[model samples]
Target: MAADDHEFGGQHTDIKLEIVEKYLQRYSAALHTWCDAVWYIDAFAGTGSRTVRVKAKEGDLFEEPAPEYVEQRRGSAKIALDIDPPFDRLVFMDAKPKHIAALKALKASYPGRDIDVVRGDANDLIQKEIKWDGWKKTRAVMFLDPYGMEVEWDTLRLIADTKAIDVWYLFSLSGLYRQAARDMSKIDATKERALTRMLGTDAWKSELYSPIPPAIDLLGSLEREDVRQRAADVAGLERYVRDRLAQIFPKVLDPWPLPPKERPQRFSLFCAISNPSPKAIRLAEDFGRSIMRSR
Candidate 1:
């Protein structure tokens, strides 16, 4: 039976297809040769399907693209990972039971494909046995999209230190900033710790003191354009800590840096990281620009 295309919907759009496409393009460009394997891990794999509308250039008409259509087209780069059970694999993890089950069912329908669906907390699961053999010195993209601020800092640190995986994470600053800024004392310690870790310092509190325009101003002053771009770049860095991550991992490749106008959301931020390769950053910028153009 052919695999179902509309299996993972009703979930919010974390990072859109354009961003993923650019990452794939950049990763492919940076590699000297075809990669031995590549892993695309989705930590919050919704129902495994989504429906999106594309506007027609001529008319007010909009066309809906099936989730499978988008996945299959952009997923070509993933063929090696799925074929022959290549050491490279695509892993989808989600805390939700229904989402996990749906992913498992979808995997079953696609025989000979090496897609692993696990039900568990991504933070805890990363600590478990994971085969990084194929990932060593190779590129892997991990999509970290949590519902809110629940993602653990430890997990991000572990992944960052691995030097193997380039992270594309979604940090919902609007949600957390609104909640935490109201009463710092009332916020959960874990959430506070996670925010601190994400920012790489307690200095974020200083934003309240400065007359500058919110968090974007502080982030933009950093020497690293990647850091500055991520913060003040099109989507607004405070929405996500692109600048902070770039600051913490300065040794890694600098980001391509998107202009504010190119980002998808006026209030959100999106960026990418790779091991000592500007390819990821460039791709991220291209993706960001594409998203803006699409709008």
Candidate 2:
């Protein structure tokens, strides 16, 4: 698929880069403070690099290769997890054979690393593997960016229950809600399952039939405090998720929830979930604030 066709890079800009950079900085720094080794996992890893234009020293700009974290110095963090084998330690797993082949070629380019480019599903991989035995003291950040809603909630629940991994998930409220609301019959089963997992309940089913306006309208109203306080309510929902995570892992910190309006161009929501430690909370909050400030 083309970069522009993807929801993440469709409207690629510097702000998108900034939001990811902030999280990478905090995630990397936190791992460094906690353990001697850390692992970075991108469950929905794309073609390793995206075509984006960044500002240069000159007056003009040019399209170049950019990964999820471009600002940070290379080797500052450990392995990158992606379905594409751009890195040596890349764990490229996908349902498509072509994707696996692409990752294989990419992996061959980089030699001498623990790369596991399996042609399978990440949810199954996580269920069977991604343990906490050897990684007891080590920190791992899992980036879940599905194309639509193929990610299962049970998988996420299991991952969260482990308390050994922090998740940087892209919740496509607008995208998924829009599709499901428009055509209930057309909604993919995988997408529905993923939505259920992310919402932590079946409450969304009520919205399907409810006279709720379009997602754009709802988000617009949410932006205004006078009209039923939609934004506040959405923020509350995020808090609810954060609290639930805290209950599962008391050491897990309150998630720093960034609403879609904050970065309407790049994402609808950007939340950071980590273990409940003072340092972790601070780092998450700092990253969230940086995202808001960047806008």
Candidate 3:
């Protein structure tokens, strides 16, 4: 893939990437003994490795000598491909056509590997079209990394409902909540739908806004108002998403109890583990705590 063709984020994202690589490595090893064929599915897989400009900042997960453009980091697609004992099957889906072409090229690069590339909405494709005949027996690991709050809650439910798959989700809190102004005067229609899809319901309106005003009087702090308190803040919203996932997933693993105060604009990596094993607990609890303590 061309250098400019992929999605770009801050160098801090590599911390999350390294966690993903570590989890994939340990997870596959632990399950390979019992499962016959392990699978890796990336719903929002980028072209491959993208560019990340590294700069020192507070709550930074990665450290570097100086602020420079990073090139050694590979995207999820490449990292998963390099895992030991490797996945039996690899599935990649992205809404962008260019990303599909990029994946197709990767398929050409590795001719013998079993890789399926689909171009469409992952919410529908993963739920309806993707065949899980082998998945039920061997098990699967899915990575859902959407740009904003594009991933639907029901899609998460469907994946967790399998009882075998484990998921790593990047829930973008800053991107979604910033869509609406601080005031409750006006709301964007498209953002309204996106928020509903992300949260699984319109309950966020009542949770985030105070007094829960009617549609006609959605103006100012008089009747319908914005909650200026920390209770309606971004951290609160992130926690709410995790709580929603806990209802379906038996074990919801997150490194932080709340959003990091230093990087409020960044997304938090959440691991929704199903059918938790001993290794899973160590990875989520022990490892997660150590990582947070280091920060």
User: What would the TM-scores of all predictions be?
Assistant: 0.61, 0.61, 0.79
Off by over 4 Å in 3: 1-4, 53-72, 130-135, 212-230, 255-261, 276-295
Give the candidate number with the greatest TM-score.
3
Per-residue lDDT tens digits for candidate 3, residues 155-218, read 9877877777888988776775676445444566887777788878887666666643333445
Q: Which segments of model 1 are wrong by more than 4 Å?
A: 1-15, 25-32, 51-87, 127-134, 182-194, 197-203, 206-240, 250-267, 277-295
TM-score of 1: 0.61
For model 2, residues 77-152, the per-residue Cα lDDT tens digits are 1225321222223355666665566556666766665666676787888777865666556666667766655666
For all candidates in order, the CA lDDT equals 0.53, 0.52, 0.73
Model 2 CA lDDT for position 51: 41
- Estimate, for each residue in 159-245, the C-alpha lDDT of model 1 and write its tens digit: 766666767666665554554443344456776666666555666544322232233355576442221111232234452355556
How much lDDT does candidate 2 score? 0.52
Q: How many backbone clashes does candidate 3 have?
A: 0
Candidate 3: 10-residue stretch with minimal lDDT: 221-230
